[model samples]
Target chain A: MERDDIIEYSLHAHHSAEEGVKIRKKIYFVTALLSIITIVEVVVGVFISRSANEFANPGLWTSIKIGYIALTLIKAGYIVLVFMHLGEERKHFKWMILAPYIMFLLYLIFIALYEAVAVGHGMTL
Target chain B: MSGEASKTIESKVLWGGKVSPFSISYGKMMMWIFLVSDALTFGGLLVALGFARHAAVTAGEFWPSSEQVFTHFPFTHAHLPLLYVAFMTFILIISSVTMVLAVEAGHRMDKKKVAFWLALTVVGGLIFLGSQVWEWSTFIAGPDGDITTWADNATLKQNFFLPTGEMVDGAAKLGQEGPHAYAMFFFFITGFHGFHVFTGVLFNFIILMNVLGGTYEKRGHYEMVEKVGLYWHFIDLVWVFVFTFYYLV
Candidate 1:
């Protein structure tokens, strides 16, 4: 009976066999897969920065900045959605966690860029 | 249904028993409440960062360029921008990973492994805090032989010229230089976050001692680690925004 109990505990812990196995494996696989996407973010950021430095033009520079922002947003979104398990949650829960944040972040970004750009009112781009 | 009611009554009595008065687990609930408060703290910091940026302290004169302020010795001394911040970001991400592993070990009830990972997380926190100190010192450069402080990029841009000619009145002529309110905000926000990390490491150290001494062994589970892990993760989450707004953005 002791040997049987040990086997049952091992299986339950390792597979979560008592709860189920497929969901656990899926979470594990998804986490490993998303790690590749994170590596892509670093690589893309470096590439954009390198190219911007090489060309050293205003238009190219703006594009590089956009790319950086977009890539960062992607990485952040993925981490929140997957690692934090916000994606698997109910829709209302998702909005409860993210909506206010989106609104607040937008407000901050608007203020930052607006003030930054408005610094020199009469100066030409 | 009757059996369920009896179990509920038993649980209520058990929870109300002496030596542990909480209905729910005290540690886990406290962690949640702490995280809620911490979220507000971070939100306020970000809002303050926005306010400072909106104040336009530099304006057209200096424009407060991050690239200029952060030039350092990592790649080359001539002029490297934002690289140090990127390194700091990497340090934080790695620390968060170690923290997750520590929590994982705790879940597995591996006391020694939990202690080892917690120590790693503490060391990572210390290293990151040390890097911030170095970053700050480099930012506030020393006076030269002629008593002229180094002209940072912000000053140069504010001057609207490459070479900042001279000081107007113990201040650089190139830009609207000198410490401002925004500087105060930066120091306060970063200092507060660093203090959290420092205190967090101390808290984890206490838990480590307790675990090592078999206090947790008698307690029947490693719930303390789970409680502290929540705080540590919240700290890491706040750093994510700090890196973006304060450094990258």
Candidate 2:
């Protein structure tokens, strides 16, 4: 009975074939999509820099920043999902690993943006 | 089943079902855990780099536009955007493929094939390292004329201070900012990654020799292939992150 119970729990915890295949497909699709988006981001970052137009002024930089973040998130998502095998992991394990990271990242971002904005305001003065 | 056989089975089952320091081979499981920790370190560095970029850009420092900085041919003064990084990316990817092939050969117990594939992977790694060296030299040299040196190795201060106590402008100034902390980060990160590649090549070489000596053959299956493959793939995965964060971003 003890051995049977152990086997049952492990079988549940162990990575399954059906899930692996699905995750693999998802990874492939995400990689292709991310590659396309990366190309677009590089082109826009480079080409738009040369322009002296109004849309190129504040808007171009803003767009580039947003694009960079979006692309990074997609790449990170794929890395975690596929290479790290998080996609097929137990929901509790996933949360345990990533939740702290997500929280800390957001906190760091807030502090950085706040400092940067303050510095910019000071520079203006 | 016979009583002795049944007893033997019970003993096996009892021990096998439990997770113990001895039951789980510490070496292999530790490798996985170490790899995961290394991944987190890389992730954190990249995140910190992201934060730096965000803060600096918002603070009115003209981000060295990636296109303009990277645009260069060996001899001719021509601007080629995304060409160098793309070439480097392709080289790393090809090396990754060769690494996979080496792993396959190891699985088949083909020592010669594994050695050959691993050697190619090493060559590819060397080429990538050479390319990185050139990139770093160009970055530190600071254009054709201006000699900008960072005052101190401080992260807070922009390293590129002019002789006139001003930030180096676009035009080739007489005394420019020496390489800043950004350049330092670039060198350290890429240099560290290159060192991993170098060491990985050595690991493959050792494995090749072991295989030639009939070590794994005597032991049974080629599980070493799986172990090394994990390292090889981890290297490739790191490159993917580096290529994204360092170049495109």
Candidate 3:
């Protein structure tokens, strides 16, 4: 069967050995970054919860949550860019993938802030 | 050469006729799009969680803080906070790395390495699924009790021991009506993610079989592996946010 449908990018693309090395290094770097971030988050969270005691003072929670989410977003960006190879993608394509998520994140942050303020006023939105 | 020809075509008209504007294949682009929508779905769930938590917190009702509950490790009775969940996060992250390695091997047309890395990925996914199972059982079993006086005592006693090392209100009410939404959202979000891991393992297994059978070798490419890799990475990415909202924050 002389079928010719698989017009993929350079089917037998045997990239240079150095290129493979670079890719592997990037993967390791991202892994290390993610691991460190997770550990830092846990340690900081547990320490603050015990020391400041968010249970006693809920005011600190909003600030703590902001830091946690920021770190988590950084880990997520590395996963998408390096592991998923979205960074290697075309310029416009990168934005195409990211813009929607960015907008959703803004909306989420807005809601979170609003809730924090509203709860203080004894209101639910 | 095709490269020279495409360079001219790219500059002339990216969206006209044959060239893919995004410079990605249909399947890969579709996978990316699907993942975006899936991310939104998860975002909606977390938003709902936030809404419930606020309502609960404002009412002075019981809301289980992450530091309070989820202290059980697989073995040993040390009151560790966020330790087990941190391990789970580590496992998922490692699996995502292996998946990237597999995809890289595919890029270089190295079938053997692809299979090897994919096998590791499948094992990692299985471990995560098993960990979730243990976690859920501990959650559902509640705290041990005779359950003679109270009907919902066992379930209620799930709040038996928090990491705070103190029980509020002394054997009754425990800060008003218990943490219902906390437990509910825990189940829904983690269960949904566990299901994704289960399916991911199944999918990776199928793809691994193809790799072993030399299907990709015959096809002269392994784009299928790359596509699966994208899905695997997406799962790990979702877990980061899940771990943040549920465990860390």
Candidate 4:
């Protein structure tokens, strides 16, 4: 594995050692980004569970909840754009693949939080 | 997946065809299509979980704090919150990175690197699946007996805690009243995601075998590895949302 001695038969495939190093660097960067976000999420999440009156401050609690979802979407985006190579696709095609998901996330976040708040306020529906 | 140069298309024949308009390989395109569809299905499941959560809220309970519920961390019971699930998230992310490396190796036709990364990926997937089993078991056998047993009780008691550190009947504190809707959603949503991880591990193992047997070597392409890599990444993607709705929020 140390040496790139394996046969590469595909057209336009196979990168030079430098190119491989660059790609690995990008992967490492994305890995770090994802890990840092998860750490922040867990730390804050645990802090909220421990701190006084988390639900007492509705505005702050709501922002923190939204922040969790935001960080989550960022993680999902990295996995899609970097790990799944959607970023390498054509521009229009990339959005063609992404529009539905973007819409889905919006719909989910809005409805779930809206319903939760409404119900917590004693709304029936 | 040839040259990245974007050539202009003639306006007159624009609608005629470029079945592969993106110039992506047929296999890769199909894999993307499958993943998009699969993503929607998983999204729908999460939405369903969201709706079910609201339904529980209507009944006066959404859920106990996830950290409190998911506190068990294998060996000791020192009461670490979100630690186990957070570690699981880390594992999935690492496995996803390995999957990317495996795909990169396949492109370079480096059989050894591909095998190494893919083997590590399979191990990661297995660990994740095993952890899911353990989590489900812990969830099932809750603070009291099995969570299912508590569902039948009009008022159930468990070691559920509020942020204030006050101990209360977990169900009463969670839902305030009603059948255990949280348990149902927990079973279905995570079970569905767990099933995906199961298939992902299976697919990764199968591809690892193909890589080992040099099937793609003779075929002159490692596109199969890319396809499975897409799937593996999708699993991690789905888990992000699952972790959000099911555990984090």
Best candidate per lDDT, number? 3
> For model 2, what is the error of residue B62's alpha carbon versus the real structure, in angstroms, after optimal superposition?
3.1
User: Candidate 3 lDDT, tens digit per residue, B103-156?
Assistant: 889878889999999999999999999999877766666433233534454433
DockQ of each: 0.11, 0.15, 0.47, 0.33
- Between 3 and 4, whose DockQ is larger? 3
| Candidate 2 wrong stretches, greater than 4 Å | A1-65, A68-125, B1-28, B104-113, B142-179
Please, what are the lDDT tens digits per residue for candidate 2 over residues B16-87? Answer: 435323222333345556666776777667766665655555555544444444554456555565667766
* Model 1 / residue A90 / CA error / Å: 8.9
How big a share of the true inter-chain contacts is recovered in candidate 3? 0.49
lDDT of 2 at B137: 54
Clashing pairs in 2: B148-B176, B148-B177, B148-B178, B149-B177, B149-B178, B160-B177
In order, the Cα lDDT scores of the candidates are 0.56, 0.57, 0.77, 0.75
How close is every model to the real structure, measured as TM-score?
Answer: 0.65, 0.65, 0.85, 0.82
What would the per-residue lDDT of candidate 1 be over residues B48-141, giving only the tens digit for each residue?
Answer: 6665555443343333434434556433555445566666666666666566555555556667877887788788888888888876655555
If ranked by TM-score, best first, what sequence of candidates would result? 3, 4, 1, 2
TM-score of the second chain, each candidate in turn, equals 0.76, 0.72, 0.85, 0.81
Residue A25, model 4, lDDT = 96
Candidate 1 structure, TM-score to reference: 0.65
Q: Tell me the docking grade of candidate 3.
A: acceptable
Instruction: Give residue B20's error in model 2 in angstroms.
Output: 7.5
Q: Kindly report which residue pairs in candidate 1 clash with one another.
A: B61-B158, B62-B158, B159-B174
